[model samples]
Target: MTSPGVHAFLIIVRVDRFTPEEKNTVDFIKKIFGDGAAKYCIVVFTREDQLEEGQTIDDFINSSDQLKELVQCCGNHKFAINNKLNGQPLKIKIDQLLRMIDQMVQSNRGKYYTNDMYQKIERQRKREQARQEEEDRKKKKAYEESLISTGREIGRQEAEERERERQKEQKSREKEPQKTEKPEKEQYSTREKICGCSCHKYPGVIHVVPCCSGTKFPFSLLGP
Candidate 1:
């Protein structure tokens, strides 16, 4: 009968004696079907006739913190029913329970409970997590690559700027005037020719003549 899936899980418990085991009932259901089972749960508190006069279901729920927490975990969906009731009263409570189940179905977007649903949902979650991680890794890699590329570009630009400065300095040096060396002073000899003779008489040079007399003169003496 349960091959297809169940729309609601009626967790019936006696209101007169809400035991500790009863408080842990929803937890057991979660253990079997998964945490999503809580949304489809409708807590049916049987034996509402035992409640003291003027003591409502809310009053009973508020009396116990554990019970209250459990109910809250089940989306606060609860119903009180007196099993001894007959006829239209029972019918009305049954109708209200059906309506609550219908509302729960609508809230769940017309989904039902199955073990396969939990496994499928877990698989989807894992797939989504892996996809997100892969995307993040790609983004990180791209960012790192961009940083390295930017650094290289900056280094290239700086090198180009330095080269330009060097070229500019070289051109400036080429445009500047050059210094010329002074000409060397003429050298003069201290000795000179003495007497006039057929031999060449050289100024500022000494000569011993083969004339009637051989003589030598200083550089200050001039030949006649």
Candidate 2:
């Protein structure tokens, strides 16, 4: 349907015998092509040999309500041809069709057929595509932002956990009991001052000795 796009659409029909389905095609064409469609459409009738003597295309139109209505819808553009006939008759029909085409072209100032509805549809399609692309871009940006936000949240939580651990350790150290030891008092004993044979009782003659030093009296000190 999209091939080469349509410059003009030919609607062929058997003038003498029209089926219900065929008659409906006219309305369908108009619907698809829109208002400008009629200008480029031509009603072509086949089976022209079926016409009785002196019967013409006008006579056929006058005879059939469906045909007349279809022609009117196409702006009264109609032509007839008989492929079954040969020589002069076929030539005449072909010539008549060409003349009608010429007249239509001239009336339209040599403009080719165009479908306003098709163009409108194409424009709408472009607009829709652009809108979809914009939506996709917004979604992508939102996804990236979400990832960034998640990362920041995770980093903050980790930092807070570390801070909590540090505070817990500080509080533990503060709560621990401190140990203190008092200085011990030295014990002194009054001993008879005897050094050799000149020892005399005197407070200055003796010095303070540590009890854990394994010391003995003066007589033991003189032994070795």
Highest-scoring model, TM-score: 1
Candidate 2 achieves a global lDDT of 0.71
Q: After superposition, how far is residue 33 of candidate 2 from its true place, in Å?
A: 2.0
Off by over 4 Å in 2: 1-7, 87-89, 115-117, 121-224
Give the per-residue lDDT of model 1 (tens digit) for 93-133. Answer: 89999999999988998887865876766676688789999
Local error of candidate 2 at residue 36 (angstroms): 0.7
Across residues 1-224, which tens digit of lDDT does each residue of candidate 2 receive?
Answer: 44334545677888667888777776776555556657767888898878888899789888978878888877788878876978997788788787787787667667655455577756766787899999999999999999999999999999999999999999999999987887675345435222222233442343334222344445322211
Superposed model 1: Cα runs more than 4 Å off: 1-3, 118-224
